[model samples]
Target chain A: MSHPTLQELRDQLGCLEETQRRFSRTIPIADAVDRWMPHGGLPVGCIHEVKGASVASALAFSSILSARIAGEQGNIVYIAPDRSLHPLGLLPYGVRLDRLLLVSARRSQDIAWATMEALRCSQVSAVMAILDSADLTSSRRLQLAAESSGATGFLLGPVTSAPIAAPITRWKVSSHVGKPGQRFDEPAWALDLLYCRGGRPGSWTIEWREQRLNTLFNQLATQTTREALAG
Target chain B: MARRFLSLFCPDVTDDRLTQLVEWCDRYSPLAAADGSDGIILDITGCIHLFGGEDKLFLDLQRRFHRMGIQSQGAIADTWGIAWALARYGEQSIVHGGNAASALALLPVEALRLPYEIVLELRRLGLSTISAVRKIPRSSLAARFGSTLLWRLDRIFQQAEEPLTPWRPAAPYRASRILAEPISTVSAVEYVLHDLLQEICKRLERNRLGSRHMDLACYRLDGTVDRCEIRTSKPTRSIPHLMRLFEGVLETLKSGFGFETFVLSVLDVEALHPTQLSLSQANPVEDESSFNALVDRFGMKLGFDQVNRIRVRESYLPEQAVEFRSAAVSPIAGAEWPAYRIRPVRLIHPPMSIKISILIPGGSPVRFFIGERQRRIVRLEGPERLTAEWWRDSNSRWGTRDYYRIEDDQGLRFWIFRDSSEHWFLHGHFA
Candidate 1:
């Protein structure tokens, strides 16, 4: 008898279809970046981290990501360290201020508890928590909670702090400079995928346009970027 | 049958002390009020059976007062007038129904709570006792004295009603539990609270009412009481939801020694219509309720103010553009935020002052040191001049602010402004 391949065994066990169904409910990040992820987008039911960005850049990126994952009518719970979120700035990122629940918790433990609570709630589609730092145990707990409820979690560290061991994907974001004479019509960021569970690392220069974060591939912008690889 | 009222008299207490004493007496009945500087009246009509009977209830009151170093007299009768009179003068403590006339027959006319001059005049007319006053015809008494005498007689005989203003408005929805063994542990308290919550929730459901605010009072073995309160964003009587709200609060309760009695009172209530679930399992109604429950949970853990929703305000100033409202409150349909304006994600309130070196007096900065690092502006936007709203506040001292959105060589953007005095301040950062 011939040995079955991994895909054939997975098909025979009926697990491949279930896995596809689970990963298929991805939160589409951007055009070029989604093609690089194994699941074609940021997978739901898991925690993702955004690091190496300034306070403003991290907030803008996470808010845009949260709005994309939440969709219309889905509630987004944001746990922040203070009452500093300007709702006006979020409008440009397609965030529905009406569907946003802001939880201001000062303590690290309180922030973790609130994030877990929001993740476990089926009513919430996305939970974005801005923390000073997060450890492995808390990150794992948050991941398990999101898995149980199928809600996407974004752990945003305003500054580039130490990385943790648990998030399925870790992203490093920095403000990307425009061409010397090119008009800076919109904000742009260089998103670096430093780690992925089942995919290779990649980089992209993305910008906000038409109420969504889209990949920027203009010759002038791509000059600063390294070679784009297909996964 | 007429309702019964209880009257207690403290000969030595003053007005302030009597007010406090009336509040303590609320445990006996819902309607407890301070009758005068020396007395308290309680409407214990159907509440007697709770303490076994009127005699037993009276004895309990006496025991409590004696323990508190007070010499008190108490009486129960068909009306507050009779109860008040009998508590002060009648030999019997409790008068049977329809026997108010016979009960006050031997008491002095002063027992009718008449004015001092009327009592003295009644004594002068040889009509000192209530029975002696009753001997005179009603017309004759009305002719002799004014209507005050007749009104007082009618009140004593249960012919007129007098309303008593209670010290605290008793909650219509309340449940209490008296533990056989005082509980000191948090788990035990939670168990008792769960039981009480079920009872109250049933009542709320039956009446189609939901409570927005609830107060839990734990009567400790000592004289003091420990209380904790929980409030929801919307009216709710869900036992599990309410129990979750109490989980964090129960731990903070000081069960010094132990708590013997627990009372949960619904402080605020609103009509909550029954919802009809759709045939399809996934509906927006369920999601809305669960979202509200999540907000309530966070509000209970943190303060309600800590859980907020941002609302846009109609103001020109950046700082006055938005306000944070507690999530527990229903959002008022406010003005929709206009298309995305050039605003920073994080606005540094009361813009921090920055040291700048400008080549031209009214021009943009050549270099500014944010902390110790010097930043050279690579790209500069504008000198968008915004004048102060002098019409809004005439006392305003500041004039115009020349704002600029500038990016440093590292591509870091800053929203800075130059005031009338040429001082530059960093207001916000573009994301």
Candidate 2:
């Protein structure tokens, strides 16, 4: 048999190559997303930890990410220590209640276990393992599970969490309300990527408007990225 | 061709131990039984060769029972009736093939396992042994005993095979470990658990079957038994994965007063097809098999009911739009959720009562109060009107709600609706 043509090969590899790119690269944060973190966006197929000053901010950040990553099918398995998540609160984040698989495990071990378990299912596109404390070994396992399953994983913890070099990307989300002229619009948030393994990290002011997330970038990319890095 | 049947008379074992003894005999054959009338019956027809024939096998059984502090009378004969008659009455005895009728003739009428009144009547009639009963006229015996006597004689004589309604095979897979000394330590318990699990898994692998539910019972020295059951979402034969799932559950078991024996049984099993591994599995499978282990782990760690998944319903109403079910059950297939203009991620059940002010008659909400926090609605959208099906529920009483999507100053969005009675309720929030 003759060797397959390059055109035929390209056609066969189009879907696989696109999925690989989609899962490995950064995603769009708000318009200001690029400036805060050197990494382009959240890394897919690995755990991206989002820590907030408190539980509320951390939870809000998780909701934003969960809704953003959910897309259309399957569930965002949310493993929390408590049933404090109000289904009504997730609507603004673009997460539908029907799309969420709520796993309320009380123990830290259970949370870690559940997070890893959720990552094993490829149908589960995203998982939020929100906890007060986390173990290093379990977190590493969670990372591997996500990578093997090719699903995005988020670890939401309090900002009090000491920086451990486990997550593919680390972020701190700041809650922002509608101001002055945008009083009629929905709430906004500011996300600052602390570090990314192989990409630029920057801070961005993002708003949820109409039906989609709009990035608010006001100036040139290089200048703001440099300024973000200096800070 | 004659068959060898081993009938064991467990005279010392009462209620629970009888069942245990029946399970203990499982190694000999799958068709072990204790009909609850008396002792365990085993049709070891062709299996005697496994332990070096009748003599060695019976010796081993006797030794094991003796070590366990149980007294048993066992007999092996060509027929089940002869075997049962000898084991229940005679000292542990074995009748060679073709000698079952002669052996059974010496046993008393009581050895037939007949009722007390029947034995009394038989003794009164001057017929007390199987040989004496055989001397009676067959029709007279049938007339007096209602055919049971003739039937019993026929069975005992090996002229006809006794109808054996064997009890259902005890849980196709079962394993038990008896400790020489009662063990209460966590490490000892874990070791025994692993050993028992391994034993059961081996049998499962041999049969190519997987079990979905397993029950572990710890029999304490105080004669108390504590049992814990774990269920899996998918039938599995994986010993390592099952061990992990049982780890959390085993910790909670009280080895109180020390456990002298442990029994692990597969309560439910199904044929688990072997999954062939492809040369290159480029993508992770998203089928029930992929999520089954995850669900099982969660259901075991957290309460099974605590983990619930949602399914979109085929309805237009908000409450009827979604359904919540226990995680143990598989999820509804397909992603074809009912289409809607916009569905809220979070819906407040029974809608929170809120104070609302409308700027114009039949207009959208301009202001609302949730608890003590006052939210000024900056922009409002819709009057998506829906009416309750009063015909479906007479209690609904023709209730109608006009829903509106509103944005507040906090950048939070709310889904509020006003009923026909003019009471506005906050039904959902845009998270």
DockQ of each: 0.53, 0.24
The residue-by-residue lDDT of candidate 1 on B1-431, one tens digit each, is 56989999898987766766776676678788989888999999878888899999999789868867888998998889999999999989999876778888999888989899999999998987999999999999999899999998787676787888888788888887767788899999999999999999889989999889999878766435678999999898888788888987888998888987888889899998778877776753534338788898899998899999878887656766788889988897666665634667777866888989889876668889888889998877777777777667742434677788777877777888888887888988787
Model 2 C-alpha lDDT per residue in residues A182-217, reported as the tens digit of each score: 422255666567777545566666667765567665
Task: State the DockQ, from 0 to 1, for candidate 2.
Answer: 0.24
| DockQ of model 1 vs. true complex | 0.53
Interface Cα root-mean-square deviation for all models: 2.1, 5.3
Worst 10 residues of 1 chain A by lDDT: A222-231
Please give the TM-score for the first chain of candidate 2. Answer: 0.76
Interface RMSD of 1: 2.1
